[model samples]
Target: MSKVILITGATKGFGRIWAEAFLKRGDSVIAAGRNITALEDLKNKYGDLVLPIQLDVNDRKASFEAVNKAKEHFGRIDVLINNAGYGLFGAVEETSEEEARNQMETNFFGVLWLTQAVLPIMREQKSGHIIQVSSFLGLITLPVLGLYNASKFAVEGLTETLASEVKGFGINVSLVEPNGYTTDWSGESAFQTQSLSVYDPVKAGFKAAVSAPGIFGNPEATANVILKLVDNDNPPLRLLLGSFAYPAVKKVYEERLEGFEEWKLVSEEAHGA
Candidate 1:
């Protein structure tokens, strides 16, 4: 079945690939991003099937307007893909508080606001899927990408809770945690601190390494997973994409579960029966 899908940050990177993938699958997509010319180009290629709506998901007003426009176009949104997010590399002391919070605003709170905006409509219709594109860092803590990890960790928690909340309403919330895809996720898209002397030398080294392009998993492969997510009768709430991400997610789970078990007695004692 074809569905109306909306993706944010569709001007470039994996978001753009996602838009193209969905459109090829015959899904009506609301291609949203900050770049007008890019969005216009998409509009020309896919014509009416691609609704290139300009959006910066950080703005509450613009975010809501995009949702409303998508609704107006398709009558309702079948899938909402929150893929418009970025990473910043800096230590806690090295990066300004303002920079850290900005990361959260885009990766964490922007998702929250957009999810909230779409919920009521999905609920009323008794159907929809919300796909939050978090990174493998969402599950595991990265060295210099502390702020990025922190924001995605929050996204993981939020989507977990959201999944349970909308179960009865027949709305599904899916999280896609990718390792690194063929996106322009380089230093140009990143912001770093002027001073890196605050953190230890190892952290500084890690921070410096992030400025260059690392091994990137294919965006098309990731988009194929997204297509699966859309077609499934029962999609998983959490999915780790790519060979690189699968192991990382597994390690994160094992470590987290072990830590919980090791500290279980203390937690149990606190809530004495």
Candidate 2:
């Protein structure tokens, strides 16, 4: 049986690929994004199978209406892909309060609202899949990318709690953690604040590393993983898209485990005293 999938950030990257893959599987999809032209192109290419709607996921009312409209199109949606997020890369101190809030608004709150709106329908239907487009940075922290990392980390926490809570209701929550997949992430990764006083010395080197090729896995690869996830008999709670993400996460896990053991005495002493 074919499924109905609603995806955000359909203008480019994973969203677009997901849209194409779902359609190729003969499923209906509602592709939502901020770009009208891109949406139009998707519509032209996919015809009625792809319903392109312009949306900025940050708007709660718009998101609600979009979900409802998608429901009207296909009668029901089996999957919701929350992929409309932007990155802001800079030191935490270098980022303004407004910038930080913007990051959370788009990445965290936006997904929250959409999920809340859609979950009721899915619950009523007794089954659905919610896919969150998280990142490798969600697990490990990098020096200069604190602002962006913070957004994804919140996503990790949110999804972790929600997945357990919703399991009994027949809804599955899955997360995609991908390595830097040659998308517009870097260009869109805003610099909340810039100053020679802060990044002057090593700025060039940082820029070089960031702009390097093969920094991320292919977007189509991420899309294929998502497509497979949709049809999975029992999909995993989380999917790591590239080899790069696995080792990085393993390092974090081991380090945290060792650190906990090393600090066990202090922790026990504080609790006991």
Candidate 3:
């Protein structure tokens, strides 16, 4: 069955691929983005099936307006993919307060704002799916991408709580934790901090090594997994995309568990009598 799917950051990368996949599968798409030209091109190709709406996800009012417009155009939104975010590459000390705040505003709060806007309508309908595009960094962490990790980690916590809160309303929330993909994420779309002499060696070594080709997975495969999640009646609270994502996250969890168990006696002894 065809449904009305709204995707933030639908202009490029995973969002664009997901939008295309849905449209090709006969679903209507509300392609919301900051880029007018790209959204227009999507509309031209898909015609009425694609409703290209200009949306700056950072603005609360704009998010509300976009949801309203989606309702007006498609009558109801069956799914909302919160795929709008950029990566900030820098150590915690390297990133300015403004840069950190901007990263959080766009990644964490933007998802919150848009989800808030769409929740009321979904509540009334008693059925909806909210997909948050988090990264594997949300589960683990990276050296230079600390700020990006912070934002996605915040998203992970928020979406987990949201999933529990909205289950009564028949609204499902899931986090898509993807590893590095062949996208513009680490390229033109990424933001970097001014290199400090202190961390230059660490940055130049490990970061450079991982930024090579073939390590990143394909975006289309990730999108396909998401489509399956959308169609699922009882979807998971978290879905890790790409081959690398699962094993990497699993290792993180195992290591975390080991540390916790090792410290169990010390942690328990610290509790008040």
Candidate 4:
């Protein structure tokens, strides 16, 4: 059966790649982005297989309206890929209140609004897949990416809770945690805050770390994995997209476990009468 997949941030990068993959496989796509013009080629090439909608995910009303429009156009939504978010680069102290709020508004609240809007539709259908494009940074932290990490961490928590809440409704929710990809995520799509001289060394070290060879993955390679995820009857709640993600997350989790063990006595005492 041909599925109807709605993808946000479908203008370029991973979103556009995945959208094209779906269209090629006969799955209809509702491509939502801020730039409708960028989507014209997809519409022309794929014809009715693709529906481009102008949307800025930060707008809650627009997000809901976009979902409604997709439903009306396709008659059903089999999957939703919430991929509309950008990276915020700055040390925690260097990040301004406005930057932090804007980061959350789009990266976190955008996901929330769209998830809320689509729930009713999926609930009616009794089956649907919701994939959130998180980051490996969601599970671990880097110096300059504090706010970005926080945003993705928020998404991780939200999606995890949502999975449990909607399990009875046959809704599948998965967070796609990818390591640094060769996308414009860190380039044109990213927002960098005012730098602080105090953190120059930290920033320099962080820059060198990210520039390491094999730290990034190819975005095109993710389409098959995504296809398999949505097609599976029992998809994972968390799917790591890049090769770097697994080992990176594993090391972080191991350290976290060690910390918990190290503080076991204190933790028990805190819970005591």
Per lDDT, the best of the predicted structures is 4
- Tell me the deviation in Å of residue 49 in model 3: 0.9
lDDT of each: 0.84, 0.84, 0.91, 0.94
Model 2, 1-273: lDDT tens per residue?
989999998888778888888888788988998885877766777788988888888899999999999988888989999998887866666778888888898999889888987998899899999999999888987667787888899999999999999999899999988877777776663444554366754556667765766666777676667878989868888898886889979999999999999999998999874
lDDT of 3 by residue, 147-206 (tens): 999999999999999998999999999999988888999899899888788988878885
Instruction: Write model 4 residue lDDT over 127-181, tens digit each, in one string.
Output: 9999999988889988998989999999999999999999999899999999889
Q: List residue ranges in candidate 1 displaced over 4 A.
A: 198-200, 204-215
Candidate 2, residue 197: Cα displacement in angstroms equals 2.4
TM-scores of all predicted structures: 0.91, 0.94, 0.97, 0.99
Candidate 1's C-alpha lDDT? Answer: 0.84
Candidate 4 lDDT trough over 10 residues, lowest sum = 239-248
Tell me, what's the RMSD of every candidate? 2.4, 1.8, 1.2, 0.8
TM-score of 3: 0.97
Q: Candidate 2 — worst ten consecutive residues by lDDT sum? A: 189-198
- Candidate 3 regions exceeding 4 Å error are none
**Which regions in candidate 4 have their CA more than 4 angstroms from the true location?**
none
What would the per-residue lDDT of candidate 1 be over residues 1-273, giving only the tens digit for each residue? 789998888888878888898888778998888886887766777888988888888899888888988898889999999988888876766778789889999999889888988998899999999999887888787677788889999999999999999999999889998877666675467777656665678676774654445546777677787788888879999888877777767877899999999999999999978
- Residue 270 of model 4 has an lDDT of 98
